[model samples]
Target: MTLQTNDSAPHPNQFALLKQRRFAPFFWTQFSGAANDNLFKFSFTVMVTYQLSVSWLPPALAGLVIGALFILPFLLFSATSGQLTDKFPKTRMIRAVKNLEIAIMLVAAYGFFTTNLTVQIPVLLACVFLMGLHSTLFGPVKFAYLPQVLSDAELTGGNGMVEMGTFVAILLGNIVGGLLVTIPEVGHTAVAIGCVALALIGRWLAQAIPELAATDPQLKINWNPFTETWRNLQLAHGNLVVFRSLLGISWMWFFGAVFLSQFPSFAKEVLHGDEQVATLLLVLFSIGIGTGSLLCEVLSRRHVEIGLVPLGAIGMSVFAVDLYFASRGLPVVPVMGLGAFVAQSAHWRVMADLALLSLFAGLYSVPMYALIQLRSQPTHRARIIAANNILNALFMIGSSVIAGALLSSGFSIPQIFLFTGLANAVVAFYIFLLVPEYLLRFVAWLLSHCVYRFKVTGEQHIPISGPAILACNHVSFVDAVLLMAASPRPIVFLMDHRIFQVPVLGWLFRLAKAIPIAPRAEDPAAYDAAFAAAAKVLQDGDLLGIFPEGGITKDGTLQEFKGGIMKILERAPVPVIPMALTNLWGSYFSRIEQGGAMVRPFRRGMLNRVGLNVGTVVSAAEVQPALLRNRVEELLA
Candidate 1:
């Protein structure tokens, strides 16, 4: 099924989505669910660790056991949940899940009311597992529902708001749970009532979510978790980019999990601060992630800019490594409160590092999520996200194991942070090398955002899916890069073969998989090969970009269209979209009055205003070199 566009907002931003019916109710529903999950789990952990005395579940192992129970459902039920999400109406499933949360919280409230420590311990532990199951079931529906409701233009902002909301909810949940459970006389009762109240609030919000048809209503239910899990992985693996993105996102979870799990010990042992300092670290981290998640829409110009992924990776490594330096060699002192910790200048750097590290983590993750939603097959999108969740659970489990081993082998928490930071650089480099699109987009994003003030008009005209020929008036050497920046999907450009011989840019084009061509008279074989490649691109349902003028404009004016576009159309017969790159003339990459391009740097200085105007598509039957040229000229005008 084709993705639906929400035209509720003429121009949509992250916050603007909060007021829209399509987004707001669902946002609060998921937000309340996350808050309640964290609230219940953190409160239970605190109760067991400090108040309750259980022989089987000791203080040291309380967090570990609770966490294990929480993530266990993802491994056992995520595949089944994904299938169910695709099979049922999303609103129905959302309401059902919220109903389940209410039932589970009621059981938890009874467990909290029990005065017997022995009975209460098992009951709450069971509640932890039940809450994990709640999250597992909701995971697929939460992500899959967005693409069904929001337009491609709103996907980034919507995902940003969701991500920001989720982190903020977690922060609030932890704070509320921690505080409510610490009440002197009625701690348990307050937590019990609070859990039930949040669950009811979530259910109420779920009622307001608009009904959405299932993407794969005819899909048969897969009950066997083991086989279905394998099948789910294979489905995700069908698209290598999507699959690798799943892995990238999982790695991010693993990376962040390590820091989050270490914060308590790191605060107490390394920073010489009390429990309040650990809470302080959590607060800073959550705020940073929320700040970064919100910044994504602004930084990406409201597009699914995966370029930020690499930028985020770099910042994560940098700040993480700096955190080790910031905290190492601190003098041992009596455990200090939050106020004292903040008063010390040395601790300020430590706080900043943690905040910045988590901030970059937010940037690294939101695009990957949006990209997965945008690129995955709508029918199988939920399953692919399920695979991502499974991987995340496994990665988080692996992180715990590895961190435990590292600590047992005498590695300090600061040392572990240093090690993770160094390892992050290697992992990011490897992933980017494997998926060069991330690196390519990073370069294009840098040029468009840093080198120029790039704007796109009529971008909604570009087909979100299917084959189309993008015919543009080529003004400079960097036209393809700017176009790539403007486009949500990758565009395979047909360029002059000689441009392939240009130094650094050549390598970049090759990495981007741009096809090169020569004049038939000069090199018939190369010309034929280029057109063959272009046809294959369209045949595979990808965008093929062509500069109808054949090369860059020499005098910064429109040139007569060439017959190359006609040649490609004759083979693929896809719709041709005329585009115009404006205000790139006289820029550093364009041919100047003196002649050669790129000979002088910063000719137009920084943030030079440039734009790509995408005109409406012309049918294959009506496509002609002259017709396409006139369309581009009109756009240029």
Candidate 2:
């Protein structure tokens, strides 16, 4: 179904989208499918380890074998599956994958019904591989389908809810799966019935999903998986920003796998708790992730705020380190149940650390998922997701190996946790260094929220893509940063050169790619360079923001427009958008009138209300300093 586009209307938030038909069915279908996969995987693993142990397969090898078997299909068939999704309507492909799940679940039911241990265990492993295959085929659709159904404004929250649902599903699946298969006489029957039921439910839900058009309908399908896989990986690595996001996301999976895989051991060795503690930790982490995921929408005000990613990384490291401290120097403690565990304050602190870890993990990861979807080329998006899946599998597998090596070398679980925490700091710094835009955008977002609450209107006037000149009223010292925060696309600001000489802000301005303009009389070279840089930015089809007033408003009134905007527009020939910033003149950054004498700008308020009103775009032929000023003043009014 082609939904009607109402550009003039404010976009509905993530929750509102959940109530709509287009998103609801698909969300439930995907959520159920994930839940079922984990349920079956966990149940089968339990049966293999306890009920059907064999001479050839040790209990320790069971988990490793299962892990490898599950990820193997993603490695082998993800490339092929990605092409299939791109060639067909994603909704239809998803339905087909759900149908495949039903058939596989029937086979699993038969395996469970059969009493032969040898046959049953192999069937279970085969089921794991098939589920992996099921997930691989669905991977690209899982991501690519969202952008089809959601608007850009909804992307971040949509991704957050999807990821949040997934973590919750995994939690329930593990808990329920473990319990279902331990029912003694009815264990096999229960597991069989549950799998078939979940498969049926997921397929029924998939039926209601609206059809989405294939991105590349005429593209030829590659017959060979190996060659196609290589090509798909290449497509994913094409852009530097996209590729670095890929690495960041893959590393998150590695970090998660490391911590999650250690839970059983951490609980047993450190807390002296049994099976219940493991489950408790799992539940706590899931809730934390869900909370953080939901909070992302609120924190970003429905934007994909990448600054949260860095904040999350910092929190993850700090909390992980705190967990080490909270749990260090442990004495012999009784195996406490959930209630007893909470009774001790020390254990509560540990739980707090673990919860914080999970919360930050959600913050760190959910944005990248949305970013990957929004950033990748449309035709190759599914392939890029495939590439991400490949990298995730590799990283997870690598983490397992590293953890095994560390533990085998006589390292405690605390030591491993500390190492992982420290490792995350190094990895985060490296990735942020590679993509400074994520960090810079983060800084702008932080500053905007901390000092002023922005009410932005006519933001749609700023083009989503291509070149444009944004001329705004300069009301305060932080006008550039506020405007940058309001824009979806990064805006290169042309600022007074003196601001570049101020202590730490100068470096930040340079890092933000701001053009430092000087008066022709004072420094002709800097003045010329500023105009040259502004021209280059527009020539390359990038947005450039300039405060046409030339300097900040002195007495809370709009200043006269300068001729520099006209010169910049003459060189670039892009649309000139006029914006107004109002209700900020008396704030900290604006000059103040003292009782007797004029005083400099001083800090005066917290969470002050300010508005950034973007006026309509003016054509270059009619672009004038007076005309732009009039438009800005009208908006400010």
Candidate 3:
């Protein structure tokens, strides 16, 4: 079901989703929760550093204890929460969590007002655990709720907005939280009051969330955490793509944990700055992620394009390494405020590297989220998201351990950043090796947008799920790549047998599982095999692409449609979408030369303006070749 998108020709943007009621309430609900989390964490951590400096109660050990207290609940409760969300309506679950947050914050206010460090610390720690529990319970609901709230085409935009909202909130929390608790004039009371107030506001906004039905209403509740967790993991492992995406997402968390865990110390030891400087660094990273997240929608044309994952991974590592270099060998200087810190050129370079690293992190994560939402089975989507959260928690916990180990072994923060950046590259390569789809999509998407000014419209006309036939006007050799880049789903392109035998393109085509076809008179076996494969593709509920014009147009005009589409429809009746490619005839792939032979190839028309327009799907019975030709011609015109 395509949830109505409020975006239209006048809006023409990803942010349009924000104006709609279906997404805005939930967006703020999650945003406030994240802000509260970071504010509380940062405030307490900063306060402890200044107030609790004894050898037995070192700031480092205090941080470790706090981290454990907060993350433990995710490890303990994520699996259970997934089941709960699946069984109960998500809005109800969401409202309940928000109400719980208010109570947790009130207790926190009481502890702060006691004016006793011993009593306040433990109470605050318990508040951290309860907050973690709140986030853990809502994790699945936050992600799994999107597919129901927005259309497939809007998934990337929705995820992007949420990511932007979350990190910006974190940035706000970091700046506000640190100063609130650490400022001598204000003290902890200000923080306590703010947190409770924020929680109340979150609860009030959650009430605006539209009602949503449970995905698995009759799902049996499993009481055992160990057994339930194992089952949930298996459920996530059910799909290879889903599992790999989960690992990628978890690795990102691990990477983020390392940086976040080191933020305060890194600011002090490496940059020689105070709380304000630490807040500045958070600002840089937060703004970077928000920028990258917003760009993902425009870059992928609002599709769950995993190509950005590799692009993000590359930028993350490169910038991380650069950050180490930027931080190294600075002259001894007294700790300074944000203004003095930015005055130094070396420090500015350090900030640039940090900003670039996190910007790519945004690009890296938004798609992984949208992909999980798009790929996971709707009935078990929340459980799958729960599994992701559990893994994410484990990875983060492990990151703290590894970073601590490295730091204990005498590695400086710069060394750790360099090594961590290199580690990101290795892990990303390993994941890409396992699933090349991410990389291939990256290359194709890059080719379409960067190499050419390719534009697309009517992508929403394609069916969001199940089997469908994409019948298009074949214009050039590069048509397949551009189409694949534009499409929402992986398409099995029916290729001419001879082109399938071409050296470089053939190998790539084989990897994409493009079908090889020949005229029945020339090669009956190849012709028969192609049709059989096309039928099986549709039957198994996958997209199949057919050049109903049979071959590339020699005169840049729509060619006569072939009978293959009709035959395929007869075999496996499904929706047939008409697509047309324009502005490619003069390029090397087209037959623009004399005698219908090609001339200069490969970027000869460098940065050419190309257009790929998709049209609404037609019923199988209405997919007559003559009518299909008319539809293609009209779109091209």
Candidate 4:
């Protein structure tokens, strides 16, 4: 289940290296942390529901409180955590956080040992909230660290491994906690011992994570939650692509929260099952999510693949609807235990339904998080991610409220599932339609990966999907086409005004809607029109591909990037995704002299070994025209 050891491959030294300082410790630390969190939460929840003698409220309210305690830190502390992640070394901070968990767990153990409801209740809630706080601080550091330690090619796989580990740990912890609470004589002391042991394991693991400097070590800590939270949200909103990705991710959380929260009620009301069956339902969901999270690495071809989102959505809807019908003929009687529930054929349908839902949930969420990491400005990446967590919390809270209303209105659990599935379909359609970038990225990915034969590096620096200004080293006229083919989104190229009048290429450019710009002194009107078009494309979240050298290189060497890019960015305000066309320098039609033939027919062997290198998005705020031009030059070099 642990993907950490498998990262390198199956070699003699791999196992030895896995236990070495570079990998084992951090891996175990994160694993132990996840395990301990679920263990405490699951045990506390089970105790409240089945063991407590309190008569004031139902068990469902306790479940809600558990959910609330876990989510509260995201609302209040995530912004501060974001700043802290940027300001401190990740491994050091992680070690410190693990120590804090040890302290928290000891207090938790004290409560468990006492078996005092009033004392245990407050202590338990405090532990849950503290764990939430720990997660809040850990979130940004975890994301930011990957890009530093992982190569661009390894990022997707690394992320997949992390997600897989986290969820599996969750499942084990939940199962253990449930079993511990349900056991006849294990008592609170056993629970305390388990938590303390897990905490110690986590501390040992934290010692293994390699040290990496903070993304912005000088970043000031902003302690005020309210103003800083608003600021973080605004920073995320500044990039439309990132903002939309955040929304998609938040929607996924909302979907999950609603479904998970409704499980107990659904098991009891629809499946006519008892508490044990409800526990099994939760276990099935956790396992499914863990499976799906690992599968993302294979499904995405080790990249932030947006194509999986629609696929996940479709699967969710299909399985959800099937679940409704599957429960239709089931007996309206409580199942005695895990054995009887499984021995019956109907329960398998419920298990399948939960698994497929979790699988789809993983597919929908992973890419969005990766996209945000890939596209967000480095200086503010942590803050933007914090903003994402905030939105996720809000959406989940909203989902809970909506589900309660639906249940109160006499809708059966099956009916609510049907409704949620349908609503998800609508929302998915609307978001994709509004911002076609996700769809277009999939298109670009298919074209580059399936249609072309090429190798590339520095591609991570390139903005994969967004309103980007791609300034590549121009060579042949088809330079635009090759770049477009490499790109995963439709690009609006700013090309020579004369090319707009060519026969076949002209019509093709027109059809693809390439933008044509004239030199400002030559045709001011044309120049103005080109700028306007470029701005509109970027604002619409489309890529703007441009040749900043104004024309093909005549000497098989670099030419100065024209200032036209500056004009375009002034209007667009989108990030610039720099690209380099390296081997195309010697291609035919790459005019070698001034005023040479602008139109050259195809030459033999001109397209051999054509390659493109993409770099990351450069924010408009940091890019002056000269600096951007230089940055593009360096990418080519």
How many pairs collide in each candidate, listed in order? 0, 0, 0, 7
Model 1, span 285-365: residue lDDT tens: 999898888888889978789999999999999999999999999999999998998999998999999999999998999
Per-residue lDDT tens digits for candidate 3, residues 1-637, read 1212223444335677767778888998899999999888878887777765445557767778777888898888899999999899999999999999999999988877776767877888899899889989989999989988887768888899998998999888877887788767666889988899899989989999999999899999997888899999999999889999999999999998888878888999888999788878878888999999999988887778888999999999999999999899987789999889988887889999989999999999999999999999888999999999999999998998899899999999999999999999999999987877787788778878777888888767766567888888888777888888987777888988777765666777777878989999998988988899999998988889889878877788887898888788889988888888888877766777464434555636577888888887788878799999999899989
lDDT of 2 by residue, 321-370 (tens): 88888888877777778777777777888999999999999998988888
Q: Give per-model TM-scores.
A: 0.97, 0.95, 0.92, 0.73
- On the 0 to 100 scale, the lDDT of residue 82 in model 3 is 94
* Alpha-carbon runs more than 4 Å astray in model 4: 1-24, 55-58, 334-336, 343-347, 444-637
RMSD of 2: 2.9
| Deviation from truth (RMSD, Å), model 4 | 9.2
Q: Name the better of 2 and 4 by lDDT.
A: 2
* Model 4 TM-score, all chains together: 0.73
lDDT of each: 0.91, 0.85, 0.86, 0.74
Give candidate 1's whole-model lDDT: 0.91
- Candidate 3 achieves a global lDDT of 0.86
lDDT of 4 by residue, 232-266 (tens): 99899898878988898888888777778888777
Q: Ranking by TM-score, best first?
A: 1, 2, 3, 4
Q: Which regions of candidate 1 are displaced past 4 Å?
A: 1-9
